[model samples]
Target: MTSLELQRTNLPEGLEELLGPKGLLTGEEAREYGRDFMGEVDNAPLAVLRPETTEQVAEALRLCTEHGLSVIPQGGRTGLTGAGVPSRPDHEVILCLARMNKVRWLDEKNHAMAVDAGCILADVQKAAADANRLFPLSYGAEGSCQIGGSISTNAGGTAVLRYGNTRDLILGLEVVLADGTVLDMMRALRKDNTGIDLKQLFIGSEGILGVVTGAVLKLYPAVAERECALLAFPSLPAVMKSFAIARESTNDRLSAFEMMPQNGITLACNRVPDVVDPVEGDYPWYALLEVSASKEGSGLFEMLEGLIERLMEEGLVVDGTVSSNEGQRAQLWRIREALVEAHNDMPHLLKHDVSVPISDMADFIETAIEKVQAIAPDAMLIAFGHVGDGNVHFNICHDLDTPDGSLATRHKEVTWAVYDLVQEYRGSFSAEHGVGSMKRDALRRYRSEAELAVMEKLKTALDPQGLLNPGKVI
Candidate 1:
């Protein structure tokens, strides 16, 4: 037998029987779980373990630990980072929680819901909506991304301006340590001042510390009224100024304030079907503003109209359009989604999910654009993101007509220039995306030695064997 076949056959004895045939996947079936959502890392694992319950996960971990095998905990595998896949071929096993998908309970009175880590984010949102509550953690991948993976990455979507990141939405977690010890800290209370917040450790740890089996997520009152507007800005400064005025005048109803560049909108309108620019005139920048209220008849539509008129009069907004209904609102939002889809297949695209202080957003973008132009003048910059939270998806790629491999040589140089500027502004290199194997170098380069030491100490304390998602995060 070949070495890979030998390794596959050496899987922890009785594992197949313990998990049954359907739960333990090998050969071609196992390779399907080896890659990430981005198809960036495609290392085949020895086996793929699909556990149906928390106990099954714990027992599997115990067996894997006994056999001195490393385990990679995976969720919906919709993460842009390579955190949910095996990093080495035939050297590890994937412990996918997809089969444990279940909505355990929902407490409308308490404004909380218990769910299996494998539960789809959209399903959880629907469950909360059925209870007349709102689970506002939303994004493009909500249709496929699992709740556990969102928690693991501390995902920040467009709604982060009003709600918060996934870390804030989670009230409790149920984690299985490397050695199979179950830490059940699944409390739904909002105010728990008991000792240390143990769940926080694994929130953005990316499965390096442990595997999350379940979660208790916080919910909010359902939005009764909402108003959306697509506003055009003559300059980046105008966009930021309008954002400030809108936030202050909206009576705390401003849920989303997203910034989209002209290039991104143009690409979306040209490439994505039914995704057209909402406003006339070729403005340099655009902002998608959404205001929502829990109380019915909150006059949000009138409020947004008045806000737009004032901004226009002040020259902060050059052109604008408001959504009169849900369909119109969805059409406006489609521009943002379409921008992402438009360039997904582009060659040698370098995506940077970095965040800086909100005050320095416009200046950072302007200066970064200049620096990037200096590196590759022909590169197309598709910079857009949640301006309210200061997270910029500063993606760069070669011009459409350029050759496929043109930007391959300067990819590292372009990325380092952007990240170095982020560091100078006291910003995070990897903001919403966790430090997977891809960003391990950035983590080491950006983080201080003392900070890394503490992280290493925690990893040693929790996963001393270093057999849980090895070569990831720290």
Candidate 2:
């Protein structure tokens, strides 16, 4: 039988009745949620379940579990990896959290916000801002990505240098297990000496253990004074030195320290609209730095200006443009934001989100670029990312001069070549992007047998039938 016919034939008897017409979707409705952001995985799901309430999600999971049906927990479906999208859409049911979106409560006094898993991250940030607080988990997809997906991947964005990852920003989570058991630990507490902290397991678990239903997120004071600058560095070492000096001088006010290569900037300017390089002339490398202080009269702009001036004077910086206003700051940030879009304008790209120690970032990038060049001479290395937090989006793509070749043919070799170097540098193969189906094999190969065994045990203990997000991570 055909995939759709097989799915329709095997669907649980009470699924339709339990979900109602609007909640359960099939055919075109289900097909719409199939592909990811980049259309990398385009297989259609068996059905899509739009559960409005936590109880409905519980019921759906329970029914799917009873019928031995694997369900993929979906968020905004903006993930790069095929985590939210169904890889095996022939049989998998998509449990989308879009309908469950709600900002449950905002505690301004406590500097915490309780929100449903389905709430868009931008909305969450706005809610926090509405209360005169800051969410601090800023990313390119903030407007589209969901809270649950962000937490599931333990998203690390630009501000992770100061605020930490999504895992660190969250205090508690309300998760639904494979068998529909609700683990409600959503307490808005800064300190909890509770046993085990089961929430942490599900935070970065990528829905292997359980589906994140809701969360209580930490918040911070809103920035009263802010300064952003785009600086061109003479060398990688100079960028590193500038980072140290800025971090030390700013007194922990350094909110973001992003690194970008000239080639990537050129690509962005050529392909992406309104993407202008803030720093004039051609420079090998650049750094986008931001400093912010919540308190009024903090002299943050002066501090940033003085710091940049000192760096330029020291010969660490070749050229630079400091943001005079919020509009200018946004314009400065647009260069980094336009990178992925510019890359998509190309063909056959291999993106690797890897991380190493902060000190090793420059060396790792330098060595990896040379090694990748040796492997794929024609491939252009678009190296850039959050240098402050040691994460790099070391993406490789076909250059204009090279004849377009099959990316699939060279994918494995190029992957290993990059990953092997990442391993050598004591860096993680997968950084902000969690181990979805894309990096499952990498996890097995790199991780110790003992670690894999322990993970399997946890999987078995939590999801005995192996029904929740099967073929993802472990």
Candidate 3:
């Protein structure tokens, strides 16, 4: 059926009065919201609805449910998985929460804060800092990605090893179910042995289960003292070894730990402006370590020094650069941040966000690298990222100087080859990134039948109509 026909035939009246003209967009106005962060694919929605209030969102969903129109939930559209974009041409409407950016309240004493779904992640962090607390859900998309999107994807960032993923940070959530029923699970209690944590259904569901409207997030004491260091390792195994010694030392104050190859660092320096290498020594692999403390007397630097010294003694780390000040530390991280942009111009880059057991990270990377090389010899390899959580962005950049359309066409081949190897290790191909429309097929192939059967049961129970964010996550 045509989208307009399906919506018009099924949607009940009176919703337009509640939303008004300003909240609705059709035709070209709806085209932009139909794409994702990376233009890996292009898909459009029939209409776009921007709801300002939770009630409005629920109301919209209820109308959508009645119409049997497939809905797409959109946040900042910074998701790499193409989850936000509509897959089918007909019977789809993109519902965006960008208008609902609001911080409901703050409970400093309880270390919790309630915020609307549309609030930018960085803004939440800044607000927590203003309250003399820490909201450590950070990532490359902090500036634009919405808090709801993070919780929906259950995002894991740099500090996940210490602070945990978005699911851990979320104490409670407000979700709009498939039938437009509002599930108010927004409680700030830390230890509530409630019957069946329903929040788990929506978290990491990637909008398939429901539309996340508001959340109660867990906060932490502000970090007062921090030590940042960049260490050079011979290989991924050495990097993993260094991580163990560092974790044991300094009482495990480790906050963020990232590992990258020298070639990746060079790409960041060359491609992104203002990102320069801090050290001179040549090394195959390097790690950026960050340790933080709540009080001034933590002696974090000394502890970091002890860890580095111990790792060096064990021949785990070959070279190390300890940042003395915040400015220097920010500069050191700029290299890491610039990595994506560094390859912005590269042709046919296959970016894989995969995770295996922490113990098997080194071997996984080595094996994956070898397989990718065998398949595409000239592919410029720039693999790096949150090594602390065993999540790595294994980017295979087909050289810019490569011949014509050949490089761009090899994306499917290279991705399949690498993902096949990643699956052999029981590793997830989509780690922090959810299986948006882009990875839905991959997920179908990867997930075991038993696992998928459970998911199907949940979908049937929660979204019997299958009207809420229809073409996503599942």
Candidate 4:
């Protein structure tokens, strides 16, 4: 018998009703569910089951647990880390939550939204906007990435400068344990210091211990006034000075503070059509800055103009343009996001989603970049990210003409070099992205023996039989 035949477990009565033919994917259909976002993993699963309801998920997990079958939880399949990917062909099955995407409620009064684990991130953002609020978990994969995986990763994005990461925004969660026990703790109130904050455990755990079926997400007040500007700086120091001036002058109105190397802009213009270099002359560094005000008491244009005036007076910003309208604002933001697509087109790009203390960010980048250039001279370091949050999208992209993923292996070697510096500086290897199988060995290597042991103990305690997202995180 095949692994599928051997893996079949007795299901509870009336359990299969939640899935249609397409939902219960098997055999050849199960082939694609084994891997993840980066195409790093190569495991092919035995079965790919998609259940449309939380009840079905519980039932499936119950059976899988009882039979000692490992079940992998998947989201949009867009995660760079292989958190959602299956590790084994025969012993593992994929439980895709794509269909249980119903938004249970949007409590605008409490500034909270409750949604199913399967709901797409972009859709959740739209749902919040329609309710005249802001659900600020966003990134490149917002259009397809699910909330569950994003939560598991504790994703940080562009707006982290102001809104914070997935870890900070979540209020409550409804998680189904490895043994299929449903823990519905989806409360909206924020000040419940009553007992331990149980939901925080599942937030960044990468689904190793349990499956998140639903969530209660915190929301922010709608932005009333907004201003965006792209400023050119002669050096990283100048950019840092301008950022400090803006933070002091704007009085926390600053929404985003993004740092980009000049070559990244050039690459974006060349590889991606309709993407233009915003500045007139070549500057070494650029800052894509946006500030939003909630009450509309202060005019965004006035705030931006004042900040830029001080910046220019101090010789921080060499050349800058404040957006006169919304279209221009979007164009500036587009450059930041579209630049990544162009960077992807460039061959031999080693990507690092890492963060350090804000105070240490500038020096860290300078030293890291210098170290990298010493090794790969022609190595174009196209850096950009939410610098205010100390999260840098430190990308080392080789020439774009040679488009091949094979050369990215060399980039991996360079990653070790950078990660070594990170450890020395007390920075993290995986910052925004969680440790899936892709970084599991690194995690084991870097994390203390005591920490790893504790993690494993917790994993074993929560998933005694090791049936839930096996071979991930720990």
Candidate 5:
């Protein structure tokens, strides 16, 4: 072991006493926590702290504060942004919430479930399903992501069009401040109009304000019937027009309106195993839409059929495929879910999670494609995302024919051009993905001065010593 390992094992004062041998991890045992999902940034921390209970977390925080040790709160480490990982890892203690995974109780009357922050989202969804209810915070990382990280980042996924973001699914939160003080606001009430809702402060703060230890998440009635369809569009305008029509025609039952380009689907079909194309032939754009009803006999299938027929007649959709059973529906959804995993194999790729006004999405895509092609002529664009919510995962990959170092030289220019166009259209550069260290500069460039000032003031007020997740999210 190195001198750092010895020092970490021999922690300062009350820390070792509060957190036992299993709670504290050092050297190799703690090394993996320092790395994130994408291996682009690596920061080996001093130690990894695992506190099983809220009291344990509080004591750890209090001890760290007293000893002047920086604490970086981390969850499943599935975030695209570097929020869970630390910049100054040698001096930071990663507060991993792995041990706090537990469901405290299910309030059937209140239609909510109180869960520890470390609870896996998939487990929560399963629990809700067991109770004959639904937890609507669906995402690709549901199998691994913890509730705390989801709440911290305010994750947006396919279900955002219907159930809203993670913020909407949460009713209350129990957080621990930098000084180890516990702010318990775990109320399972929907109509709490008493002053400012304290839980909202830490919802999307990304652990900059404090660590979320527990949450009371809102639940909904489980869907009894649903329909899934994959439709091919001749152009981007047709996709946007179809989105508007879907929203207006579905009677508010449309759960997901995910868009994918031909290249994106091609990438998934070619790279990811067991992910076959749902439709025949190729089109410029496609949409994987779902309409679900809580009642069994809600006529959702009939409604979808009528919508598809009308779209065909209007020349909006050139080709389409609808799922007749659960197996087919899951297969259709897999194509969309595997897109990110497929693109993960690219040698050099640039990713941007941005959102534009629903009305300007088509124009933004057309103009961005032209501009990006001009910047990197050999680059292949793979743009797709939740077009219903106006969030697009505008991404590009270096063509195999391009010479090495060419993309590296033009990376910055291409990024700036894309963001500039997004800004020109009055869209957000960072949509669902929070501003972690990777996007800190972008946040500074795009965010308003007054808004940043308020965030800084709040940070100072909460973490006066600046020891909690330093250099993250304002």
Candidate 6:
């Protein structure tokens, strides 16, 4: 038998025997894991290894490395970037941690929890809630996105303004290196003045450094009261003005300040079922404000009301509505979630997850819109996201009346225009989505030579073979 054919045959056989039939999958059964959450990448791997323990993962990595095969470590596969799936068909093996879903322990006193990397983010949040604590890392994909993927991307969600990103919420990590070395740093302590902080290296590395097997996550006090408001603005400046006023007036109680455009809200109300706009009339922009406190009778509702009243009188807020109960609050937040869902099926959509300084967000959006319009005059800009943290999901939808492939042809030009504008404003082209295979070019173009050199040196130091999640990040 040929060496290539023999290697392929023997690799699967060894994996099957080591991991058993249930743990290893090939052929059509493995195709589903090959695709990402957005169905953007559909290249099937040579084999899918579902390891339930760290020891199994270590052994699997050793076997794959010996065979000169590349391995891609995947969690829930809910990432927008093509980081979790195979970049090429039958050339790489996917090491998925779905079967390792388990909550190891929860310490209420320490306000910490230890969980297997495959545990769903929602499950972790529920466990923390059950312990009378809060896991503040939240987004729409919490239902299916894994904790490991969240950490790997250093995910930032709505609550990042108050609680910070997944990086801040993590106390420790348990990682398996490319050469089968297990770096178990899963300590639950809040303060460990250890050198180097090895966990930070892998947090946002996107699996190129190592496979995150588990984590010890920090938690906060459970929220006892929350106030939600949907405010309308005549322009982007007005939105920022209201945000500044809300932030200072709330006395650091602002947990979320998401911005949504009129067109985005319209699309959500039209495309997504059961999603209705809270504001009666159409304004140029909208902001979804949320404030939460741990203790009851915190007067957050009164605070929100007073802030809105002052903003309305100041003409910063043209129209607004505050949620009186949980149902109303959910309905208001549904508009934000549905806006994202509205663009899922657009074939030629240009999605930009960029971030700028809070002070420059207004100018950045306005300038980006101008730049995009210059490229594609008919393009619809659906700008929305966690404006509190300055991350905007600046997406452009194709003009439906135009030819089918016209927008696809200009995708690169439009993306570069937006990215160039982001760079000009000292903003990041890839804010929260990560630099998977999709944004690697932007990473190269935007990052300085010094920055890239440090990244490459670290990658070489940890994963010399470049086998871990190949073709991603650096």
Worst 10 residues of 1 by lDDT: 399-408
Query: How well does candidate 3 score on lDDT at residue 327?
Result: 98
Look at candidate 2 and give me any clashing residue pairs: none
In the range 1-474, model 4's lDDT, one tens digit per residue, is 765454334233333455667677666677887767667786877677798878788888887787677888899898887778887665677888998898899999999999999999999999998998999778889998899988888888888878888988888899999888999999888889988888888888988888999999999988888899999998887877778778888878898999988888887887777888768999999999988976776777888898888888888889978888888888888888878887775566678887787778888899998888767767778778888887787888777554444335566667887888888888888888888877887797789999999989988888898888888887
C-alpha displacement of 167 in model 5, angstroms?
Answer: 0.7
Which pairs clash in model 3? Answer: none
Residue-level lDDT tens digits of model 1 in 18-103: 88888998888888899888899999999999999999999999999999999999988888879889888888999998888899
Q: Which lDDT values do the candidates have, in the order given?
A: 0.92, 0.88, 0.85, 0.83, 0.90, 0.90
* CA lDDT for candidate 2: 0.88
Q: Write the per-residue lDDT of candidate 2 for residues 335-451, one digit (tens) a residue.
A: 988876788757778889999898998898889888877777778888899978888999988886667664436878888988998898888999988888788889988889999
* Runs in model 5 lying further than 4 Å from the true structure: 1-5, 401-406
Which one wins by lDDT: 1 or 3? 1
Q: Write the per-residue lDDT of candidate 3 for residues 277-351, one digit (tens) a residue.
A: 888888999999999999997888788888888888888888879999999999988888887788866877677
Best by lDDT: 1
- Candidate number that wins on TM-score, 4 or 5: 5
TM-score quality measure for candidate 1: 0.98
The regions of model 2 sitting more than 4 angstroms off are: 1-9, 405-409
Question: Which prediction has more favorable lDDT, 2 or 3?
Answer: 2
Instruction: Give candidate 3's error at residue 340 in angstroms.
Output: 1.7
The TM-scores, one per candidate, come to: 0.98, 0.97, 0.95, 0.94, 0.98, 0.97
- Evaluate model 6: give its lDDT: 0.90
Q: What is the C-alpha RMSD of each candidate to the true structure, in Å?
A: 1.3, 1.7, 2.4, 2.5, 1.3, 1.9
TM-score of 2: 0.97
